[model samples]
Target: MKENIHPDYQPVVFMDSTTGFKFLSGSTKKTQETVEWEDGNTYPLIRVEISSDSHPFYTGRQKFTQADGRVDRFNKKYGLADENAEK
Candidate 1:
């Protein structure tokens, strides 16, 4: 309802610093940098430390430890009798 009171919401190009990946998005954040997009137009450029392009979670490079089941944990903690070993 107000004029010139709100920050400009415009298309911006966010670039991942690690992967050099660039994507177009809209934001109100200010930046002095600019980049020519694929469409041959200039847009504000914002560099980010982490993005989906290089994130371990998004790229499936995350390491996860397999949790031991209840029986396995109990056996390791109190030593279960090894029936197969005896046979």
Candidate 2:
């Protein structure tokens, strides 16, 4: 452990601009913006384009693609689908 050599780790607010989702966490990143948190304390505000709140993987709102249909077509052409597997 060294003194005066590490970046400052402090409470910061990550805000998702698209979804307006705010999260409080400790980070070494600095920001010029400040936001008043629910605890009545001002913390550094970092704006992010995407977060878990708006991401497709986290929200499970991903677009349905034709890849699955293509896989079914391939399976049917190669007779890979087991009849018992369907039942």
Task: Please provide TM-scores, in order, for all candidate models, with all chains considered together.
Answer: 0.68, 0.71
Candidate 2 lDDT over residue span 1-87, tens digit each: 888999989999999999999999999998899999999999999999999999999999999767557768888899897666655
lDDT minimum window of 10 residues, candidate 2: 78-87
Candidate 1 Cα deviation (angstroms), residue 21: 0.5
Residue 71 CA error for candidate 1 (Å)? 26
RMSD of 2: 7.1
RMSD in Å for candidate 1, one decimal? 5.8
Residue 69 lDDT in candidate 2: 78
Question: How good is model 1 by TM-score?
Answer: 0.68
lDDT of 1 by residue, 22-82 (tens): 9999999999999999999999999999999999989999977659777777877898865
